[model samples]
Target: MTTSTPSTPSTMRAIASYRGLPVDDPDSLQDIEVPVPQLRPRDVLVRVRAVSVNPVDAKVRSGLAPTDEPRILGFDAAGVVEAVGPEVTTLAAGDEVWYAGDITRPGTNAEFHAVDERIVARKPVSLNWAEAAAMPLTTITAWETLFDRFALTADSTGTLLALGAAGGVGSILIQLAMELTGVRVLASAGRPESQAWVRQLGADGVVDHHDLVASAGEVASDGVDFLFSPHSKGNIEAFARIVRPFGHITAIDEPEGLDLLPLKSKSIAWHWELMFTRTTYQTADMAEQGKLLETVAGLVDDKRIRTTLTKTLPDFSAAGLREAHRLVESGRTTGKVVVTR
Candidate 1:
């Protein structure tokens, strides 16, 4: 038998199951030895060095959620490529890389993960495994929401309001909106710490989401040109109340229901930013994900965009995974939480 390297396992440990189940059931996570996946023509096998948890991971863990068998539960990751498929030309073995793996495949929680070349990108040279691990999901989601939904141009100039600017996507979203866009950026954070968090990210103004209509009106009487929400329901009317005529509102949260009619009077457009949709749908621009991630990595490398890792667990373990879930579920984290190799 071949010996396993310290960083590379011949058969690695992963949180998985023979049957689907919920993470809360205690039977949710099982340590098992599984063969490292062989790369397909367009695939890369990464020796996962670190990972971060997202809400979707927990949701997918429970049999309550639908997915193929023996599913792995992670999304954000930073790793070292140990092997590559023949057709892969962009990356080779030992490249440091990061990615938000497709929801269609096993996740990065494993010691070794096989992913599509189009979905992976070179990791930022400046960050350690844990810090780099904090980025992929939130960065991709935030970048797509601002540039894609808003169609924000380089020259676009207007006051932009970001709702819920303390969470994972919101934190990075605030930073990019302030640094990259010509728009004068404002953000909402209900508590003092949350308010201060956005300010450190360079928000020019802050409002409370508790009563966005009134709170935002104080900042922009005629309403801001853009309203971005990373929070949940009850903000649609507030968004409608404070968005300029013909403006745009983008939200990552899955609001139970929204009254689109409220935006009708102002001719305002509403955009739903779901980062998984493109991969889930196999869109024409699916490959754009790799390109965008590469761009984000360049920014991180230059310190233009910062790594958002707020918490780090020393190793990848079920207990560690559960703690990450608890923090996310609390909805109080300021940035990302990561678990490193």
Candidate 2:
């Protein structure tokens, strides 16, 4: 998520929050001078070329005042490495790289950032910064949701239901499932445009989340083998009814308390996949993130995975980030939004 230090000047221009509140408020985002980090042995200093907005950025901005430091925003970024610390062995200055920065750090909405080599990867050579920036966060989420949480085996002899199948994570998840696994993929899209969007992304079928079970029937009568909900609620009991016995359910959203009693009868397994969990907790698998990102980059290079960038803005200005935040919060965005510097 973060490196110990950086080999650079002491300061850089970055977006930060001095107050915690709604992102629309001018005070919630400000351009500020922050220390250019000094990289640790395993750290790399990146000169950021582009950054992208996600729901976590807004939530983080809202909780800004919780810390004494100015809370900077933006997670996904692509750029060129400017310097590396002594202990770093994987990369050197001038290599193109991309990463979804650690939630515990100052973020990527800056001219320079220091990140651990274990969490950074080579940017796909086929894509530009903006396009590359749109991927890391969503890709990490979707990949982990499928492989880590759902325990999807190599054979993929299963059916998968993807809720919120038109948003950033869903957009990428559908493609990964269809391309990498044999699992039949079903997605939920509330709008006609969204339905068409998911269908184009290689979903076997699209169902309206408004009537989840009915749509599932129209798509597949026997019920799915795995259910993924980016946003979930008490009504998720309906999903329990539709998933096959012993099937797994994975969610990224923080749903309020719900009764697990219903799922017990079916011997269902529930998993929560937070993309930052490994980095945040410093799990032994932290380096696995680097490995996964490299695999994703290869997929991009081979044309198996497409960049999800749908909206682009110029510069790392606070106004641009606010607009990107507004778009993500609106819940109508078809793919990732990037801000180029």
Candidate 3:
């Protein structure tokens, strides 16, 4: 573990796990006092006001094995800057910010968390802490999926099919595709409620994922130019059939295994979008994420895109974190669920 000369109070409240445990177990998450994190040269210390739970949170928590130290699990957070490292010039103490913090570090499930300034952005002024917290992880995933991984341009014209269109990433992706590109988006929903939700988010059309072939054919006779499959485990064959020759396919979920050989005949391209890649690898362009998030904040302020925070838990506690994890793991949530301080 890394240590630094103390410059702040020693301990703060946090929810964490010292070993892997099932979500249903009471001890799966516990309240504890941890030393306030010390900062790196490019880091910012945030006083977390709110945090939003995602599938990644549950996945990481459950996969944790026994270790000497407890692991804090959270990614999406909105907070005020409590401190900044010497090299962090973009922000200072007292600035309100939001970020999808690095997965390699202690997370936002604490009263105070330190994150690299390169991936943090100013919070959207029009949104409250909970609302702002809901956007970072999902927004970064959706943005990189459409524009970065797929290399889509504003003038590109085609049909896009988005599977699981009511989930956090899908909900935001549907809106961004409509607002940022010329593509006609055809979102797939399994339930009527999800269908209505995607339409409300401005999908050009909605289709039942069960009858993907027929539903997608109605929208694009020649097949969709792009397929965005957030849940791709059982839908790869369907995607290959409905996607046009030479089209692109992108996914974010952890499918068991993919057989890409089937896509060869049509010369289709497939890409994976993991938003954590940039920060995890410390890429040369990591700072681009902060700039892009700033752009997203501006879009929110202009009302061109809206926050997808559909639910908010009362406060950051063991009970609240457990419930949030259960809701996300249920796989029925329509948008984002947040826990406020």
Candidate 4:
């Protein structure tokens, strides 16, 4: 085996997995030591203080196969910068920051991690580390789905329906639509508690997915102008019935299959929003993520939006990570779940 250089620092603790296993399996996550990452020219090294769990984490972990190297899994993080690469100009040691790290590389489940500077932004001053950590991944997903995929603007006036509004992405999307745009929002939630939660987030009305058509029709007689489906893929026919002709539908879930034939009659526009696409493809506008995070930080500081963190584990240990993943996989979580060092 290759040895570390004499001057290189030793390993850092991380919660990682060696093979795909069910969330309840003890072997699904383990505490281990990993060598500190070396930085690329556009990279910034962060001393991670907090991280949040999401559906993608569980999905990716469930599909991961055994390998010699363990896979660290976490996307959203808040931390202090420990070092910067030569080409990294916007951040430096001691700078407080938050980011949704690129999915194409090792993630933020370590004591320290390196991330591209173009995808990071200063953390919101109004929130603590865990709260800040909870926002990035979900914020990026909601923001991109609303503005990039739907092409919505502040002046836009129409009804926007959010399916599964009690989850992280939906909670934030409801607030974004209410605070940043003139659109009327109709949020769908199956449970009474979830319905109340979305209403607290400023949803103009709440609908039940089981009674979707009737409940949605009560909100918008002319049909909703946009549908943000974070869940409820089985309700596509209801979506077709309630959405206006040429209305836009955006989603982030990985349903087994979606048939567009139902939507063809209305000429509905369908769009998929995967927040990692920019960093995964190294897109030309990857820096736009940093800019958007800065905007979100400003919104949070101004009280225009709030962090959606509803649960936080005690520490950044393997047990903590596993518990967080279990809560995410449970499907009953109302908001975000975080782990802090």
* Candidate 1 lDDT over residue span 1-341, tens digit each: 21123565567888764454544555566666678876678788888889998767766664444445666778898998888787887888879999999887777888899888888899999999999989888888888888999988668899888877787887888888877889988888988988888888888889888877888888878789988876647666667778889998887777666667888999998888888887789788887898999998888888888887889988587767766777776778788888887
Model 1 segments more than 4 A misplaced: 1-10, 17-25, 62-68
Positional deviation of residue 148's Cα in model 4 after best superposition, in angstroms: 0.6
lDDT (0 to 1) per candidate: 0.81, 0.86, 0.90, 0.90
Error of 2 at 54 (Å): 0.8
Candidate 2 error regions (>4 Å): 1-8, 66-68
Better structure of 1 and 4 per TM-score: 4
Q: Encode model 3's per-residue lDDT on 219-297: one tens digit a residue.
A: 7788998888877777778888898899999988876667778788889899999999998999999998899899999
RMSD of 2: 2.5
Model 2, 133-202: lDDT tens digits are 9999999999998888876756878789999888889989998888888899999999888888888888
Candidate 3 versus truth, CA RMSD in Å, comes to 2.4
Off by over 4 Å in 4: 1-9
The deviation in Å at residue 233 for candidate 1 is 1.8
TM-score of 3: 0.96
Candidate 4 lowest-lDDT run of ten:
1-10
| Model 3 regions lying over 4 Å from their true place | 1-8
Question: What TM-score would every model get versus the actual structure?
Answer: 0.92, 0.95, 0.96, 0.96
- Weakest 10 consecutive residues of candidate 1 by summed lDDT: 1-10
